[model samples]
Target: MSTAFDILVALGGLACAGIALVAGNRIGSVAAFVIMGFFVALAWVRLGAPDVALAEAAIGAGLTGALLLRSANRLGPVREAGVPIAVHGIAACLSLALAGGIVWAFATGTAEAVYPSLVAARVGESGVSNPVTAVLLNFRAWDTLLEVAVLVVALLLVSGLAPVRIAPAPPSELVLPFLRIVVPVAVLLAGHLLWKGATAPGGAFQAAALLTGGGLALALCGLLGAGRRTGHVLVLAGLGGLALFLAAALGAAILTGGLLDYPAGSAKVWIIAIESALTLSIAAMLVSLFLGPSEGVRDDR
Candidate 1:
């Protein structure tokens, strides 16, 4: 049954990708792409990586689909000239070559590995019970810190573009009540994920995604304003994670004698604090990414 399920998921994912590529309409294509992301997430789960599956579903599929849909809506429908058959043929050949190379590499690679044992051996000193969390937040802190910086840079680039603001429709009676429930739930869930990350599959990225979703909901509902002032706040919030990480790195180097090396016996506290700050900063950056740099008013009515 497990093998059959895996086969089904693999086929479904392929089907979704094909549909997304061939769909005549942008909306249909985007929807199929999002479905493909879910299928890919399932494949990740089958591969025993729930954290990766969550990131793929939330960031790769959910938020990315939202961004694409927004762009599509803004651009409106327009027929485009199709690629030439020769161009398509060249592309197909290149893709096949790439696939063949990947297959060859995997077939030739050895299965020997030592990182797992090393991580496990030093897990006690890493301040987190979860090996994945310990590696990401401690052992591989530089990579994670740089990833945060990349997100900040992406937000800056996106916001630099002049925003297209569509005035939000007046909220109906049901909208406010829905926001009241969903926003709080998202916030609570994010916090839970952040805390559980120390011992489980959840972490800052997942928590940030949920919080960003909530912030987008509030912005759509006209509860959050977008303007120059708001943009400044967004910039600060977006960079806050990187700034905090850098400060921590320098401070740790001074006190602990190595960059990002937490003090012995207090690593858990430092990890939690950094993760908490990252959650907020990442959430704000994601929300700003969705909203763009449009000047807008908050409608409380």
Candidate 2:
């Protein structure tokens, strides 16, 4: 018998597909996507990974949907003409063949245990209980570090395209009180998360994202202004993490005859220090990207 979750997942995927086909130009698409996100979350729960589910909902569906909606508003509905019969037929046949092949492969494949044992064996040494986190930050740290650098580069490219002008919105009477209450609280929370990440679910990426949220809030409320577009601060902020990583590697080579090697008994300390710098740099780059070219700014009275 098909389980409730299986039914929900199938129904949600089908509904979203249908909505995209019929009313993709209208409001139905958004509704369909929201349903898709909810069903995906349910599937994550069924898979027994609530953390993945939370991230999938927060980032995959929620943030992506909001971005798409904003883009849709900016660029109105698109129109496409009907395709030629022969072309359509060929495309449909190709798509069906691909789908059939995928189904057949999965059906024929035998189940074999994989990955879990390997992860279990090494997870303790990696210093993280979460296998995914362990792999990301320890076993495959160089890859993850490069991924972060790519994000920084992308943000830099975006910032170059449109520099943020600090247009301070006039402060409402409640602004000061709100900032006073929230800024300190956010700082405290961010620091706690950063420190907790070593042995907990939280980490540099999550903590940086939270810090970026706070920075964005401050920018929106006109507490922070976009100052100079390109300066020593900006350049150093962009390169700080990379520089630190290279320095660590070189230092290791000089002291221990290996690159990127932490001294014995100091691995966690080194990792935390690198992550802290990365978190700050990432937060700064994200905020700068969001704010876009600065004109000479004046105080918002």
Candidate 3:
């Protein structure tokens, strides 16, 4: 039964991707892509990685779909340029090469995968029972730090693009009431996820994604942006996470003679502090990217 269900999911995902690739309607293609993301997320969950599934659903499907919808709105239903035969041939060749490489690796590689065992043995020392959290905050923190840096860089790139503001429409009677309940719930869930991450399947990225969703909702509803001061503060918050992480690295170097190393018996405190700061910065950066730099943030930055 499980195998059959998995097969059904795989086929459904493939169908969605095919539709997205071939659909003439821009809005329809975006919707298909978003559904594909959900299918992929479900696959991840079935594979026992709920963290990855949550991140995929929230960031990949929800936010990315929203961005594409916004872009489609601005660009209208214009036809994209046709691809050349030579380009298609080149892409096909690349796909074939990738598949051959994967097959070759599986046929030739015989070594046992030891990473799970290794993580299990050492996760206790990392101040988090969740192996994913342990690796992100302790065992292999450099990668996560670099990921944070990448988000900041991406935000800066987005800032260079012109803002795409939606034309104001008549306020819906249900919009305010909907936000009143959902925004607070999102905030509460985000905080819960942040705290629960030490032992369970939640973390900064997932929590920040929730926060970004709520912020985007508010912005869309015209309840968010007000003055230059608020914009400036948002910009600062967007940059604050990386700054805090760098400072923490320097402090860790002083205390433990290595970058990002927590002091003895205090790893939890360090991880929680860093994660909390990162959550806010990441959410701020995402919101700023979507809204673009307002007058206050643009001039200051």
Candidate 4:
């Protein structure tokens, strides 16, 4: 059964990718790519990497699909110019060469497993029993910090470019009730994921994505306030996580003589703190990215 499921997932992912590549409609192509992301995420789960699956689902499928749809809407339809056969041939050759290189490297790579064993042996020292969390927050936190920096850069670039305001939905009888119930549930779920990251398959990225979804929901429903000044404030606040993470890293370095080297038994504290701050910052940054750079005018609720 497991083997069959794996085969199905592999086939599904390939089909989706091919469909996306060949689809004439922009929206259709984006939809296929989004489905492919889900299939790829499922494959990650089947490969025993739920964390990767979560990231893929949230960033790859969910947020990326939103961006693509927006871009597609903005672009509308354009007349396509036929590509030369020589150009297509060159592209195909390059792709085949890349695939062959990957296969060759894998076939020649050493079988000796080093990092997994090392990570397992030192999981206790990292203060998180979850190996993935340990590596991300303690064992190699500087790498995670750099990932946040990338998001910050993206936010900066987006702030400069995306200034158009999306008009909020007109007030409806169902909107408030919906927000009242769903928003709280989302908050609880986000918190649950944040707390679970220390010991389970949830973390800051996953939780942040959930919160961003909720924020978008509220914004669309005309319950959340947004403007250029508000966007500026949110962006400023988004740096809070980066600051907290760096402070933790530096504090750890002061105590342990190495960067991100948490002092004995206190790693969990730093991880939780960093993850919490990160959850909020990431959500804020995403919301600002989507609803930001507006004029001084507020959308009518």
TM-score of each: 0.93, 0.72, 0.93, 0.91
Reference-based lDDT, residue 181, model 3: 97
Ranked by lDDT from best down, the candidates are: 1, 3, 4, 2
Each model's lDDT: 0.88, 0.67, 0.87, 0.85
lDDT of 2 by residue, 48-141 (tens): 7765665566545654565455445545456677568899799889989999999998899897767778887977776556676666666667
TM-score of candidate 1 on Cα atoms, chains taken together: 0.93
| Residue-level error in angstroms, candidate 4, position 254 | 3.0
User: What would the per-residue lDDT of candidate 1 be over residues 1-301, giving only the tens digit for each residue?
Assistant: 9999999999999999999989999999999999999999999999999989988988889999988888778775756877899998999999999999999989998876799999999999999998889999999998999999999888878766746554567778999999999999999999999999999998999999999899888888777775577766877888888899899999999998999999999999999999999999998888888887546344222
Residue 174 Cα positional deviation in candidate 1, in Å, after optimal superposition: 1.0
lDDT at position 168, candidate 4: 83
Number of residue pairs clashing in candidate 2, backbone atoms closer than 3 angstroms, sequence gap of 3 or more or interchain: 5
User: Could you tell me which 10 consecutive residues in candidate 1 have the lowest summed lDDT?
Assistant: 292-301
Tens digit of per-residue lDDT, candidate 4, span 134-224: 8888878889999999988888887667656666868699788988988889889999988998888989999998898898888877677
In model 1, which runs have C-alpha deviations exceeding 4 angstroms?
A: 294-301
For every candidate in turn, the CA RMSD to the true structure comes to 3.3, 5.2, 2.9, 3.0
Best by lDDT: 1
Once fitted onto the true fold, the runs of candidate 4 whose alpha carbons sit more than 4 angstroms away are 82-85, 108-110, 293-301
C-alpha root-mean-square deviation, candidate 1: 3.3
Q: Flag regions of model 2 displaced more than 4 Å.
A: 1-42, 61-106, 111-113, 163-171, 174-183, 229-236, 249-261, 293-301
